[model samples]
Target: MISEEEQKKEGKNEKLLADLCECCIMLHVGFQVSPKKVTSVGVHHLLKVVLKKEESEETQEEVERAFLALKNIAMWVKIDKELHLSEIKEIIKYHQKHRNLTHLAYQYAWEFLIHRFYSNESLEIIIVNELHFGKEAARKLEELRKNVDWTRKEDERGKETKEVLVITGWMKTIKSYFDSCKLWNEEYVELIGSVVQIYRTAKDNYEEIRYWCVFSLRNAAGNGFVPVDDLLKSGAVGCVLEDIRKPTLIDEITHHSLTFFENISRRLKEKTYNEMEEAKRKELKRKVLEKIEEEGYEEIIISLHERLNTLKRKYFYGDELSLNISDYSVNI
Candidate 1:
């Protein structure tokens, strides 16, 4: 009862799968023996194949294969980011929108792209920001938040079920953008609200989500890149205040919160911000200093000097340099 078109489509899929399998085997064996040298042209063709198959309504298995092939190729060849603007936007557009297609995307973003060799000061950042990649990530994270129960219980989170790890991995990748490129793109700023919303709503036992959310926000707050209005609008400052106020907060979370406050005030600290070219920018920096005082955050920062001294004296009693808390500055 199969139609002729359906048969042809099945044949095409089978051939594509066979090709992907062969590609994986070849790469796997080649890598074990020695590193392979793939040219940029070869890498580009492979990327095209991966994109073509992934963008189609292929089966999940096919999508996984495509990304696996991407991983293998990336191990050998640094992707030539000299891609044309139109091509860069198209690639990021698909990758961001189809982030939920497979877990391989998570590893590729973290393990290969961001963690390893991706460059800064590239057109890639501009295109990704313009495409609203961060907004797409926020949307995917919101969707994952609903199925989080599947990941909470130890038994339910078995070998094959690692949805939450994928979510965190992608969040880490985005955080790298803040630390590395430090762009002031508005869409990236908007992502902060979604992370805070998830952190507030998830159950107390769901610490992975909260931990990553705080860490990511901490980087953005401290990086001195994003505009103050955009950051304030994203609700990040309020959410961080809540975290600081929590009675049972862990030291790591508290440490990051302090860093976040420090970084936000950096605008006023170093003559560090070139945005000072305008009078409004200077006022915004002053507002940051005022907000820190309103919440008694300056006091909290002062306490960290003592806390650091105690930690160093306990763990590193013999090292005089480690004991120096005199240089610590609240910079208000």
Candidate 2:
């Protein structure tokens, strides 16, 4: 029942949408290679045009292309040091309005923003305004942790398993953001309590969840963002040492814990202990040394050294050379 002219117009629109999608794909690839150069005035203008198109005016293909373009632009802001505040705001608005309908689009858009503005304030805004990471998130995680029966297989939980998977994925994303930007500030310091609580709750729940907790803790504790005193007070160090001693713990967890310990130890060793008052210096050194000794670090290091010697003996034929003198036929 459609007229020939209307059919031709629809066909043209589809073709145009396809072309735009192709252009976006190319731009994304180019941005990956050299974002600073690709995000020039011309490209920025074209992206803005694409972004301005309303959902009603855009075909599904066009909408996807626009989102892709926005994501690339957002990523470019990270390396270029260019402030695309207006464009970023537009992407956020579009994502907020359309996230439920297209989750992946919103996800890439959200990540782009996170990477673009690598600061504690920006992260807090994303957490509170965009991701809503507060009491509700805490409540949901707590509820999921309560419902999870780790005695049974993860697959047996059905709906709860799905929820746990989603929550853990979100945790990993947040952890990655924290890892990428080492924001040492009061804002991040405040997050230590919530992070530690999540860590303790998720320790026995899922392997991936626990790994992320340790990874995030390592990054947070690195660069002195969360002070050693604070971490020790939170019992985070004890938890990490316990995890390291777990017979079934994954290598990733062990590696991150070791790195965390090394960072803390480096910080402690760098302290101006000699410059401090004698009593204070001795007290601080005593506390640190006592913690290290209580954690069985001396035994752990000795064991590692013995294991290394055993490996050397096994592989290097230590102090025992085996040569085929008969085949060599006397070198002289």
Candidate 3:
């Protein structure tokens, strides 16, 4: 099936992409040596690599490598960030439209690559809006939901490490979008139920996946645009409270859980309960709990106050609870 001319062309293109990756490595060193030595031309070459429409594994390999190289450059490059992000949006847009035209834009690897760009401050308004981050996030979460076998318990998942690769990667991808949420719309609100569902499903079986989902919730809860009403309707609070009650909870997960409660309470305080419609007020009270039960969730919250009185206190509580809950009793 192979012709000599085609074989030679393949070999040449493969070598070029390999050279591009090596050049990017050197660019990293060049930045380390003297930031001045890293010229705009290096970036121009890297950016142009993503535009390569060739469908070979070699091309995909170079695209992923180029993204890694761009992420490093983004950290220290003393250039206009908007210009960088603008070019990225264009490249992403191209792949977005063309990947469906029987091409490989690195498949799911693009999710990994896009998250690197999210660390930039421009994610708040520019790329997220243009790329439909929230909508895409919902779709990805739904795919994870359908593909994963939530009924299987952890120990029973023997020979299922392959399934885990799907879940862990997709969950990480979904969480990355929550890094810097500013603008909110119906698409963002649509995410509440799906996130809660995934957390509940993974709570018992997959610790790593559970942490990713909960941490994503924590990040979303931390922001000003958090839809308090949507969260209430979605049972997000109950899922988090369940996690907090876990006897095996680790310090980092505990810290994130506590922060979730803290941020939710702060956001709740900002709302005028007396002025809200009866439906919303009742929903908030019901979701957090009944009048006495409300105080109970608030009690857990009050415990958080004493528990997190200082950074040391918080760490000690989480550590002590995790380590000594059976050997000795502890209080928040």
TM-score of each: 0.66, 0.55, 0.67
> Which of candidates 1 and 2 reaches a greater lDDT?
1
The candidate with the higher lDDT, 2 or 3, is 3
All candidates: CA RMSD in angstroms? 7.7, 11.8, 7.9
- lDDT tens digits by residue: candidate 1, 69-178: 55555555555555323543455566665554465453443334443335435644653556555666676677776766643555543343366776676667666656
Best by lDDT: 3
lDDT of 2: 0.52
C-alpha lDDT of residue 177 in model 2: 60
Per-residue lDDT over 1-332 for candidate 2, one digit per residue giving the tens place of the 0 to 100 score: 11222246444443444344436445565433344444443244445444544555344445455555655555444433345555655665665556432333444445555655553345555455544433333444455556666555666534446546645644655565655553344444445555666677667646777787787777655655456666665566666777766767465565566556656665555545455554554465566567767878656644444333333344331122122112111111
Q: How many clashing pairs does model 1 include?
A: 0
Residue pair clashes in candidate 2: none
Per-residue accuracy of model 3 over 1-332 as CA lDDT, tens digit each: 11222246444454454355436545565424344434354455566666576767777777766655655555455545454556666666676666521112232434534454555556556545777766655665676577767778556866455445555655565556565556777777767677787788778777777887787787777676667666665666666777877767666787777666666665654545465564565466455544325435544545444444453355542222222121111111
- Give the top-scoring candidate (TM-score): 3
Off by over 4 Å in 1: 1-49, 52-58, 68-77, 83-117, 150-162, 272-282, 302-304, 310-332
How much lDDT does each candidate structure score? 0.56, 0.52, 0.58
Clashes per prediction? 0, 0, 0
Worst 10 residues of 3 by lDDT: 323-332
